[model samples]
Target: MNAAETPRRGHCSDFEAPVYRNRWRSLALALTGSLLALVPAAPTAGEIYRCARQDGGAPLYTDTRCDAQAQPVPSRTPPTIAANPAPDLAARHDQRLQREHERRQALDARWLAEHHRAAALDQRIRQAVVEGRVVAGMSAAQVRQAWGAPDQVIPQVGDGAPRERWVYRGDRDGTGTRSVQLEGNRVVGSGRRAPEAPSTPPRTTPPR
Candidate 1:
């Protein structure tokens, strides 16, 4: 061969060597990537066990040969709950509930002191009877005539005598009085043992 052809041939061989090395390196990298992709995900170490019942309602164990006639048991695993910030969440919830309860109590106190629908109705009924709006020895019919109709009528039994109640509801605030006693189509004497107002208030009010 000529000198120039010899030098060209050697250069061509050197370049081809690098190409082969590059191809081998590329093949190895591809194989490594494929192997990594095919690897299975890891699993937890716990095993499952379940029990089956026999004809006599006895339990059969798994991974053991306790009963030959027992059916194969089903596999069971305990449930895994997600992580939670229970302590912090519970504290916040309790605090919110406390605040709400405090607010409700404050509102209830305000209503009881100012409006006091129940107490006011009781007072009005006592005042009416005392001032003769309801006559002392009146019948149920007479009471109805003076105060219109009662809001509720409750029939009662088992007192060894028949009994009934006539409830009068206040028109303005929906509060009222109840008269309960022996009934025979007409009331016998009631309002005799009726509820009384606070005795302290009577004693405290200076005679005027």
Candidate 2:
């Protein structure tokens, strides 16, 4: 109303404006706090490294020491071994063995045929000995036809009825020696000697 009253009113308005400003500041702080709670916080920085440049100027960021260059480490993987892809060697070996077996069988057959022929010839010789009737006073040629060749022939040293001795050794399993006494070229006597024990043991005959 008066000049003095205007000054007092101005001072009161100033005081009220400060109170409103303080309240507005408090509301703004509360709103800022709510916004911060809703947003997610940023993650903290991990370990950092600094690598110096080769020219010795600025340093570069790396995950290793500054003195060493960064390089990928080699993985600890085992070496792979390739498998052998050879052809069927076992089958080929078996086939070769079969061929060998067949060849041996053929050889055995031929040998068996030869052995049978020899056996037949031996049988004929034995039959001839039985038919000839080898007796005393027979010629040496007749005795040979009866008993085949003698194993040994020894001349007589002193005077006697017989002038020579013809010896026939026994077979592998047979015992004793068959001998013929000869007067000149004729057979004077024929006999067998008693067998002595063999130096080596006799072999066992296989069963037929």
- What's the TM for model 2? 0.30
Write out the backbone clash pairs for model 1.
none
Give the alpha-carbon lDDT of every model: 0.62, 0.75
Candidate 2 per-residue lDDT, tens place, 40-143, comes to 54423443465568999877865444433444233346899998888898999999999999999999999999999878865754565678545765678878
lDDT of 1: 0.62
RMSD of each: 23.3, 23.7
TM-score per candidate, chains pooled:
0.24, 0.30
- Report the Cα lDDT for residue 172, model 1: 31
User: What is the lDDT for 101 in model 1?
Assistant: 100
Model 2 ranges with Cα > 4 A deviation: 1-133, 160-162, 171-173, 198-208
